[model samples]
Target: MTNNTQSLNSDIAAMAEKEFEGVYGRYRITSTDELEVQRYRLALLLCGVAFTAGLGQWLMIGPTWAWLWLLPMSIGLGLALNWIHIYLRPLHQALKLLWALGCLGAVVMAWSVGTDTMLSTVTAEPAWIWAIGPLFAALTGVGFKEFFCFGRPEAIGLTLLIPIALLGHLSGLMSGSIVMGLLGSAALLLLVLALRKFGMDAAADVGDKSVFAYLSNPQANEAL
Candidate 1:
C-alpha cells in the first residue's frame, strides 16, 4: 500500500510539473517577485486612471465631450495590462475576452454618459441610471478578474463602487463627481496598501531564501 501510494503521488506530481511547464513554456518570467511587481504596477496605473477621472468630474475639468477620452484610455490600459500578463504566463481565452468586453463597456459607458448629459430632459436620475449600468457591468468584469487573479482587496475595492454610485445618486449626499472622487481616492489608498504588502512579502521571501541557504551550508554554520 505504501509503495502504491508513493507511485500515485509521483505520477500526480509529474503531471502537475508538466502542466506548469506547458503553461509557461513560451513566456519568460524572471522571478515571482517580478510578477508581483508587475501586478502592482498595473494596479497603480488603474488607480491613477480612476483618481484622475474622478478629479476631472469633480473639477468639471473638461469640455462636455471629455468623457470620450475614456474610451481610448481604458482600451490602452486594458491592452497594456494584458500584455504584461501574457508575457508572464499564458492567459485563458475567457480572460482575454473579458478584458476586451471591459474595454468595450468603458467606451459604451462614456458614450452613454456624454449623450445622456447632452440630451436628457430630466438630468440627474436618467444620467445616473444610464451611466451606472455600463459602469457597473464593466467594473463587475474587473472585480471578477481581480478577485481570481490579483487579490481580494482589489476586487472588493472595485465592487464597492456599485453601492457607492447607487447611494450617491439616491441620497444626494454630494454630487456624482464628489462621490466618484471619494471612492477613487479610497481605491487608490487600497492600492498603496497592497503594493506595500507585496513589497514586504518579497523582502520576506528574500530573507527566507538567505536563511535557508545559510542553514543548508554546514561550513557557514560552523563559521558562525
Candidate 2:
C-alpha cells in the first residue's frame, strides 16, 4: 500500500511538471505572442505596399492620387510601431511618440490647406517640411533599427536615403529630379526590406523574450 501511494504521488508530480513546462517554458511561444507577430508582419507588408503604390501613383498617375496613399502608409506605420517589441521600453515609447506627433502634424497640414493641396503646399514651402518631417524621421528610426539588428543593406540604405532626400529638398540643395530619384530609391528599398522580413523567422524579429521580461519587471532588476 505504501509503495502504491508513493508511485501515485510521483506520477502526479511528473504530470504537473509537464503542464508547467508547456505553459511557461523558457523557449515556448504563447499563442498570443504568435498572433501579435503575425499582425506585426502584416503591418510591415502593408507599409511596403503603400510605399510602392504611392511612388507609382506619383510617377504615373498624379501627385494628388499619391497623397491618398498616405492614409494606409500612416496606418501601417502606426500599427508596426505599436506592435514592435523593442527591448528598451524608453526607446520604444519614444518612437511611438514621434509617430503620434507626425500624425498630428499631418492633420494640421491637411486642415490648414485642404487634403488635395497639402502636397503642393509642402512642396512650394519647404519650411513646411518641419510639419511632416517627424513621420519620415520615425520611418528612418525603423530603418536604422532593422539595419542595426539584421545588417540588411536595404535597411541601411533606407536609413540614409530618407534624411538625404528630405534635407536636400528642405535646403534647396537638390534639384527636383534629384530629390525624386532619391525618394524613388527609398521606396524601392523599403519594399525590399519589408518583403525580405517575411522570409525570416518570426522568432528573430521577436528577439530574446527574456530581455523583454527582465526589462518589464522592476523587481527582477532589483533582485539582480
Candidate 3:
C-alpha cells in the first residue's frame, strides 16, 4: 500500500509539471536568443566607444583624425537597432527607417561640403541639424525603450540629454560650453548604460518573447 501511494503521488506531480510547461513554454528563453542578446550588447558597446571618441574629438581632447569614428558610430547604431527586441514591430521598423534616413542625410551633407570641412560646415549651418537629427532621434528611442524596460538612470539620462544638446545647438539658445557639457554627459551616460547591460542577464534585454508572438499574429491573438 505504501509503494502504491508513492507511485500515485509521483504520477500526479509529473502531470502537473507537464501542464505548467504546456501553458508557459513559449516564455522560455532559448540558447539562440541568449546568444543574440550578447551580440546586441556588443553592438551597444561599440556605439559607446564611438560616442566617446566623437566627444573627445569635439572637445579637441583627441587627435584630429578621431572624427573618423563617425563611420563606425553609424554602423554600431544600425546594428544595435536591428538587434533590439521590441514587441511593437512598427515602432522597431520606424526606428530603423529613421537611422537609414539619417545616414542618407549625413552622406548628402558630407558630399555637399566635402569630408574635410564637414564638421565645420555643420557648426556654421544650424540647418544641418535637420540632417543629423534623425540619427539622434533613433538613438533617443533606444534610450527610452531601455528606460521603460529596465528603469536605468543612465538610459533615461541619454533620452533627455540628447535632445537637449541638439536643440540647444540648433536654436543657439545655449552657450557652446553648455551644449558641449550636455553632449559630454550624454556620451558618459551611454557608456555607462552599455557597460551595465553586460552585467545583467540576457533575458532582461530580450524581454517577453511571448508578447512578440502575440503581436505578430494579430488574427490568432484576437481569436483568443
User: Using lDDT as the measure, which candidate wins?
Assistant: 3
- lDDT over C-alpha atoms for residue 50 of model 1: 51
Score residue 141 of candidate 2 by CA lDDT: 86
Ranking by TM-score: 3, 2, 1
TM-scores, all models, native as reference: 0.44, 0.84, 0.85
Per-residue lDDT tens digits of candidate 1, residues 77-161? 4543453332212343444555566556445654655543431211345444443344344434445454555466756666676
Residue 50 in model 3: lDDT: 97
Model 2: per-residue Cα lDDT over 1-224, one tens digit each: 99999999877755543111212135445455556777887887788789778878877876776788888988998998887767787888888888888889999998998888877787788888898889888888889889988999999999999999999999999987798888889888988988888788666677767667766788977876
Total backbone collisions for each predicted model: 0, 0, 0
Q: How does model 2 fare in lDDT?
A: 0.81
Which has the higher lDDT value, candidate number 2 or candidate number 3?
A: 3
Error of 3 at 169 (Å): 1.2
Taking every candidate in turn, the Cα RMSD to the unseen true structure, in Å, is 14.6, 6.5, 7.4
The lDDT for every candidate, in the order shown, is 0.47, 0.81, 0.82
Model 2 residue 222 lDDT?
86
Candidate 2 residues lying further than 4 Å off, grouped into runs, are: 1-25, 219-224
